[model samples]
Target: MSSYFSSADLFRIAPLVVLSFGAFCLLLMEVFIKGAWDKARTAGLFTLVAFVSLYYYRGQFFEGSTAFQGLLFTDPYTFFFAALILIGTFITRLLSDERLREEGVGAQAEYFSLLLMCSVGAMIFVAARELIVLFLGLEIMSIALYCLCGSALWSTRSSESALKYFLLGSFSSAVMLFGMSLLYGLSGTLVIPDIASALSSMPAENMGILLVAIGLMLVGFGFKIGLVPFHFWAPDVYQGSPTPITAYMACVVKAAAVAAAIRVMTLLFVHGDLFSVWSDAIWFIAAITMTIGNLSALRQRSVKRMLAYSSIAHAGYMFVAFIAPETGGLSAILFYLVTYTAMTFGAFGITMIVANSFPEKTDADDISNFNGLGFTRPMLGVLMTIFMFSLAGLPPGLAGLLGKFYLFNAAVKANFISIAVIGVLNSAISCYYYLNVLVAMYFRKGEVSPSHPVGMPMAGALGVCAAASIFLGVFPSKLYEIAAYVVTTF
Candidate 1:
């Protein structure tokens, strides 16, 4: 037992330990803060510090390391994802500080602490090489999200959204665990690599185990990805949470989940020789999920709700790429994630500004609110338009064009021409609603009303998102290169 534990292994996993340690320190800081001003400043500062520390340790990725008998694998892939998760959490914390202050949210400190812990969970999730480690990572991420959903206790809608998400999420998690158990039972091992090797040895005999495990794992990740039938909680959760928190959940949380899903599928399904049978099912799911989400989004007046459904649609597009059969598919998915994250964050950041001032009641993000936004808030409207256009896959913006190109390129390479066709068609259909918001902003004329003004801190966050969107779109090659490097690590 003593031999199983060593300081050297601990150093290899220092990134996780550092994040956990940061969470603890932030908790203590929250408790001892002198006042609201001090509390907010301290919270933001702590998040920044943690992020820098994590980035510094990312250099270790070049060497790659694992610990605890290969339970956790800290390769370049893990480092890449860990960096993304940390940055996403840092932005969320910065966005949340001012909002929490204005709302006088109780336990704001706990909120930051949980956010840090959630980051820790997400970082470990990609590093997990063993089934038990993966399960624990999932729970850590889910538990923090559950609390975040209901954190605004005074709002009935918030409470309702949290309850529904908790119930459904817990059920999905149970199914995932059962699947893991079945796989372990059949393979007589809990490590994913071992399970993959075991599956290959008896492809005919292990059919039952493969089917059950694949189905269950799909249900689990499908919930996180917001695919059809599993996406009921997304709209409500997006509508209820504080806007910044909603943005975090939509972009960062969803992205990490998809990344983990890709790794799992590639290892256990594709490498295990199950991809041939399961590819069709994934294709069908992608078609339906994209179609349904786009159709549902067309009817939504609330921008948040529209984006919620749009996220589901985006997930489907990712699935389309997921089924592709090229090494570049991995790189393509990573590229899509990069563009998606920037555009989604920028869109939501603009929405947060609007909501902070207007405080939507019936429809916080209704298209009706944007009638004269072009004149009233020129920069915000323009930024929001850019986001919408990017989402629609239009030109000049990096997200729509290159993102689709990469996915389609991979699809063509894999002989998934028809799947690529449907994906493009979905993009075209999605453009209508995305453009509708722009029409409301620029072409239509109506009264503009403002309740509260946005602060510099919030503006800074929006600016950060906007710059990233354009920068990523303009020079996607750089990001693609990094993604390619990371994907090769596995």
Candidate 2:
């Protein structure tokens, strides 16, 4: 490798530089700046830098350019998801503004900085072309989140959730690192495609270690994606964390991990020789993940925990696309992720509002607290209904419905019709629990009522989400066409 750095490399990574330095500037603001609207001003700084960053991630550079002597690269695959990370982070900040005031938390600088840095890490994670660089990005994002989860020092659940995440996340990292080491040893390469190239011609004696490497890495990513059996941490973590951060985990975190998985898995499936080795394993994981996620969600009374389980099921849906990557799976996954972001934030945003309206207690998030809410808060009722309907894959909730159509269509195209049927069945199973919240809000009356006032930032954020759910559903081609083009490039 050349010791010299080219301008092309630097230009390609300029967006990340802007974001990383922007994060640093935010931390410095604590010393150099202070006053009323401090957070508002901080948010303004973040928004300014973030949009500048997005200017590049959205399309400033040609796809397929590498930075850092090929350790990181620019491509439509990277650009699309990197842009999504920025969008998700911006929305999270919008949602968090109100919560920050409500919690009256100290060290506002650290809080917003971590959120910004997490987005930086997520972008790097999705852009990385080498295993070590990928791991670096993953750790940067994971460590930021571990600390963010515990930032609410007033709550013991917050502390506990942080510890649990830190410990388990560390273990999964170890497992994944070891798997990467094994792959490196067997394939004698660290670049993912090179690793796949070397593995394709491996001697029969090394097949065992190769299989072990694949399985171990799947175990590691399964923890990150919340596949069933590896999902013990999700419901607890989601319920215990602050609501905005919970939504962050559901949207940005899941999207980044799955995008990385697609890169890794694509190398194997396209290579053909090794496709069957993991094909059956992915199928089983997808089946059980969808089944268990929906079943567990059905039992949850707390909206947060239910959404946690719902996230797991969505992971399974993405895996269905994996089964047919050659048959529009990648495009479907990209489109589904966009719709998933809109639907998820919409649901969680309203859930936060309804809970925030009542007394401050653990049970405030309970669906029973939402009784007769449709009558009292009609807007919230309508928005929440749109989100729930989308998640259930029903009509007028057309985002979820169409997202599933693309996913299952890919599966059918690949001749993997069985899993498509199973996915459809799971979709039907999910409807009961998703709609139950609507029953609580509209059909039942209870003592709970909105006692506190709210702001437009959240409403504004939710309105964007509702529009996405409806607009994207009616005119799928608008976003789907770009997603398809990006996937073709991938």
Candidate 3:
């Protein structure tokens, strides 16, 4: 045991150590400390912590090594996603501090601690090198998120979301495990690279089992990525969970899941014919997902549910990166994830702020509630406009437009011309709803009421989001290079 564990392993897992320490400290404050905290002071502290964390984990890095006896690995790929997951978590925490401060006893501690726990899990998830490690990492992430969804005990919808997520999430996990078990049986290996080595020259008789295994695993992954047909849970869960957590699910969890999927697809299914078979499946799924997602979003009245369907559409966009991995596809996906995070955080944060203007217990997220928001709250309206346009893949939303450029460019390079065309059509379809939000804010008239002022922490979070979206668009070459570097190690 002493020989198996080493200092290098410690370095490999340092992010988890740091996050676990944060969670433990927060838990200690909850148990040992007494009395309610000062809400403004608490929000300030959260903002400061997020600022400090950003100072350390602000950018992606490229590096590589094996850890935990090759059960887990450290690489530029993992580090890139680790940076993303932490940044998303910090911003979500800032929003949580502002939103949950007025809630009952222990809300702050539980919220912060569990978020840290979930980040740790997400880090483990993307760093996994073996199937069992992957399953364990995913379970850790999922269980923590289930608790986070219901952290708002005051809302029955929150409780319902948690229960729904747990039951369905468990089923998906089981489906993945069965697939993993079959893959192991066919290849006689749990290690991903070893399984890939075995699969490079698979016999015809074993191909059937291999296809079944791959299909099952993809089904499991579809739930996490919010791909259509498997995306039924997303709108309900995103709508019912606390708004900040909804954004977290949209950004952080989706990033982790996509990273994990990239690893599996890039490393495990290497046989030429087999890869083609699944790639074709992914192509069709992407088309249906993008079409169905945008069409469904067009009908939604609630902002959260609309964004939920939008998340599904984005998942389809993620699959476009999968269409041709040989031509810088993963890097395109990485860039899109980064920009999508910026746009989504700002959009959802503004939604929360605007909805707060209405009296409690009203249909706070109705698109109608956003009417006249531009005239009433000019700054928030401007921020939301930036996010919505970016989300719609329009200009001044340079981040989103460039991200899509990279994705569609990769598809064309790989000769998947038809799928690229479908994606463009879907983008046009999405503009209807994305721009509809802006139309509500700037053009429509509703009985607008006075809105609550944003807390310092939330404002800071939104500021970071808006700045990142614009900055990345203006200076994309360097970040795109960094993203390209990430997949080189793989």
Candidate 4:
């Protein structure tokens, strides 16, 4: 093989390079910054670096490239996800500023550094083509997140959340690694395309090992994406972690996992009897994931935990696209991820703002906290309503409704009508809970007094999320076309 380090390779990995560099700088700064104010300035510096990186890679969105001899690949698909993860990180930094101070999470430098490192990992995860590189990226992202989940040293829940996430995340990684080892043993290669070719040439009786490998790999991915049987850690982790970190996991982490799954499953398995062997199993998982997520969400009084379950249901909806890999399924998943990121981040941003408003209430995430928000903070109430409606997949939630429409349409086109129908019914069931929050915000009467004012940073983040959600909903054709183009490349 030719040299992996070249001008082209550097260009392909530019975004990751920039993020890692920023993270390194932040880590070094931690030793010198003794004051909370200095740490806050460092956080701002991190945000600036992230924004610069985002702009630097703006043109890559239209230029498809590959690097490191296919260990890393870039196309519209990778570009979309890389940019999405970076943007999510920037917004999270913005959201984190106030929360860190309010919650007394004093290690601002470490927190910001971990956040950037996590973005680096997520970027790598989406762009990886070889299983080894993919695993490396996954661990980089997961480890940073494990630390960030418990970064709020003042809160015991933060520590607990971090510990739970670490234990579960490590187990999943082991399962995934074992699966990768089995796959390598069977195919004698780590590159995805080579593995597919090897499997095609292998004797039919050897298929049992391949099936088992696929199952193990799914267990690993199922945990990452918060699928039903493996999603036990999500709610506790989401509720216990600092709110901004929860937003990051919900949007960026979930997006990366879905992207990786689409690449690995559709690219390698869609070609042979492999797809049929796993399609029914994936379909069943999707159905149960959706049902259980929605039903469990209904019982949660904590808004953050409720969204946690909602995130699981959304994962199931995305999995519906997986069932129909050939017929617009990839495109549907891409579009839905974009919309999901926007709505989820927006909802969390609003939640953070609401939580910040009532600093004295330890149970700020309780549904009752939002009571009569419409009467006190009318603008927040409206934004929260938009996010809730979008999540529930109702009209005027144009982005979310259209996203679901495309997913179900793809499923129907691929002749997985039952999965699509089940997904639709789950959406219906989810509305009761999503709308329940809206009712508390607008209908119920209660005194609303916020301890801190809403800063421009928080406002800006919410504005971006709301605008994206609305824009995608209203003129989805362009993005839809882009998503379709990306799928063709894959």
Candidate 5:
């Protein structure tokens, strides 16, 4: 049999190629450059160009296609995730520029290149229609992140965080791969669609093999989303890594994994014999993840750690969307992801700004550093307030309110009313810590100076994220439409 590639498939996979090529070019540029040049400028420009190209190719999304002999598939679902990752890269790059300068690391060209590579991996992971491809894409993303986490050469905390992340991440990957192997052994194929089709008729075959595979996969996904039991690494890593990278991991990486999980559980599982067996476990995890995340966040003095815990809670919210039988849950999950991204990136952007002003002390993790911030830097205080309010699920910051509303609504329709109630209570508990920051900023007074200046690059990034949060909070219909379209396309 002669194998031929399709042009439509090529077009659908264009964004991944563009990002990979851009990263490659930047890597080569970093090698050739001499002495003390600003690599961030080069990297940022390349990232922006790549994202613009991706946006241009957005028109190609609705037409579904598969490539590499059906190893990867692209539809509106993939396009939505690809758009998110690219935009995430653009924002992270801008924020990283100043950090690189502060550390006296002359060329950030390589760092940005790695970020682009990571974005490519994340996009490909969501588009993967086959098991081998999924594993490969995940490793590509993980390796890049491992390196990025430790890139702050001057910070000892960065190195430690990287080590812990690497060890735990490697362990999770091993379990996931073993599960995939078992799944393949039982199904005689590694393609997701084929596996689903195979499972439909294999009543006598050991479902245990598939269960192990999915269970291990869940462990990996849980780690990525920072859910309960597997969430131990997030607080340390978030506090220790460079702030911008932490923000990137919190928003973009988590979103990609959740998006992929939505496909795997809802789309693939619905067609397989595994659905009945998996639903209970999913419900249990969702409940524990939400309760534990909210409870743990309440006592955190480190602002970054608190946010890390909150990210886990957000994952729990998205997790509940999976229990709904209909694909409406998917729309809710995707919309929540968009809102989460805006809120989180905005929060981290403010932290990044504060880091520049008090590099020796602020550290971006200390909650006390924020005391009387409203009196010192009014604009940053206001932006931080927006992030906090949005995160707390309050109005004018739609991330919390709208995200939780849709999630709970979907659960109610699915007849998981009790689950929805617990979810709402979890959201309410989450408000306490998120609002604590606001209290610190507005109510407390301190002796610190108010004259610290904000870096232009960092400020610009913060402004964009803040604006996105408020804009989406006010009129979320556009994003909901896009998310709904993506869910239906799959």
Candidate 6:
């Protein structure tokens, strides 16, 4: 009925287009360029393209525009996540280059290309207002990650991780798609808003089908976000995958999943009789997820595996925001997501650097590997301490502390005092293991000296992350304001 390619649509979709183009260019470089130096240059160029694209769209945060017949919505929420994913990808690429070169996989251009594609997919996933579009985005992101997880060609563990992630990810996607189909069948529409409107007018007898659809959908989202019961794959996958890829999975992937879940749940379920039906279930899941994640992390000797469990627990903390009544729930979740991204990325970056320092040894991810790092590599040691403290919700200008405080406060405001209390207890439980890392770095004695110096790229990435973690904690008002705007706009 109308022209589909308006200038407005082009403006709205520029970031996604640029990312896809960058990925394609990377692939071309891989095929055409025989020199290792050229491949590194190509990867750097791709990262620059991605950063520039995001910067060009910075105006969209204030504009709050929608385009492509409502399939894409560009607002503070979308801009927030889009920028986050792109920045994460850029940082990850920086980390990946050195690691690949060190591990003898530096010549592979496909790795960086796949990483960019994953970022594109994540951006699309967060912006989708239609179910089919959302599914496409999710699969695009997931498939790339599946390849990235197993990209360590020399390691059998990487292959195992890839296979497990692929199978489980496929099953979850199928379950979610089935749920979307059920909802479409019942509501006669694929658009989220349309489904909500249709459900409001439907008869009580259809409640059973709606319930099943919701359950299936939650199961799918739960698996993606690493919530308990659906969380069995996370530790294995995180441990088996490359450290930088693990960072991407823990931060960008989880953030996208949570953003999508919040959008869908808030649109359809948060305001009706449906809210009553599902609130308790979510509350119970949140409680158990926090407890299980914290307790499991306590027994892990491998720092990477410990942080995997820690990611699960942090997901549980984020879920606490879901149970808060409408006013503060979404904003709290968004704020916590931002803080979580910074601290988690910092932790993983530090882990990567530490692993790199121990080039002569296997199992470098073990906590004991960090022994006396405070004395040997004070900067990394201090940065890791900040990340660890933030993750534990410790005070003294740590963003994680402020994030958990806001989350728990929202829970209190919503009258979920018991759930908030359990979340607090879980935060306390998490401190022991998080602090254990710090103790190893500062107190325990190491058998050997540090093997390598921290590279400039890695150091810069860690600095940015650590600073964000602190700056956000000390002055969260601006971000909170943006989060409020995002929630109110939806």
- TM-score, cand. 3: 0.94
Model 2 lDDT tens row, 366-484: 98988888988888889999999999999889999999999999999989999999999999999999999999989999775745566777778899999999889999997988998
TM-score of each: 0.95, 0.96, 0.94, 0.96, 0.95, 0.97
lDDT of 4 by residue, 1-107 (tens): 76647775676677677778878887776766565445545655765765576567656545446677767878778887877787788788878866676765777
Error of 3 at 121 (Å): 0.7
User: Could you tell me which 10 consecutive residues in candidate 3 have the lowest summed lDDT?
Assistant: 53-62
Report the C-alpha lDDT of model 6 over 52-124, residue by residue, as the tens digit: 7667866754544677887876777788888778778777766775677554354367887788889889988
Model 4: CA > 4 A from native: 33-64
Question: Each prediction's Cα lDDT score?
Answer: 0.79, 0.84, 0.84, 0.86, 0.80, 0.86
Error of 4 at 362 (Å): 2.6
Q: What is the lDDT of residue 368 in candidate 3?
A: 94
Off by over 4 Å in 5: 1-7, 103-107, 271-273, 325-327, 362-364
TM-score between candidate 6 and the true structure: 0.97
| Model 2 lDDT at residue 158 | 78
Prediction RMSDs, each to the true structure: 2.0, 1.7, 2.6, 1.9, 2.0, 1.6
Model 1 segments beyond 4 Å from truth? Answer: 5-8, 101-104, 325-327, 360-362
Residue lDDT tens for model 3, 53-159: 53354232225477888888687788888778878887887776655633221376777778888888888889899999999989989999999898888778889
Which candidate has the top score in lDDT? Answer: 4
Q: Worst 10-residue stretch by lDDT in candidate 6?
A: 100-109
Error of 2 at 470 (Å): 0.9
lDDT of 2: 0.84
Q: Which has the higher lDDT value, candidate number 4 or candidate number 5? A: 4
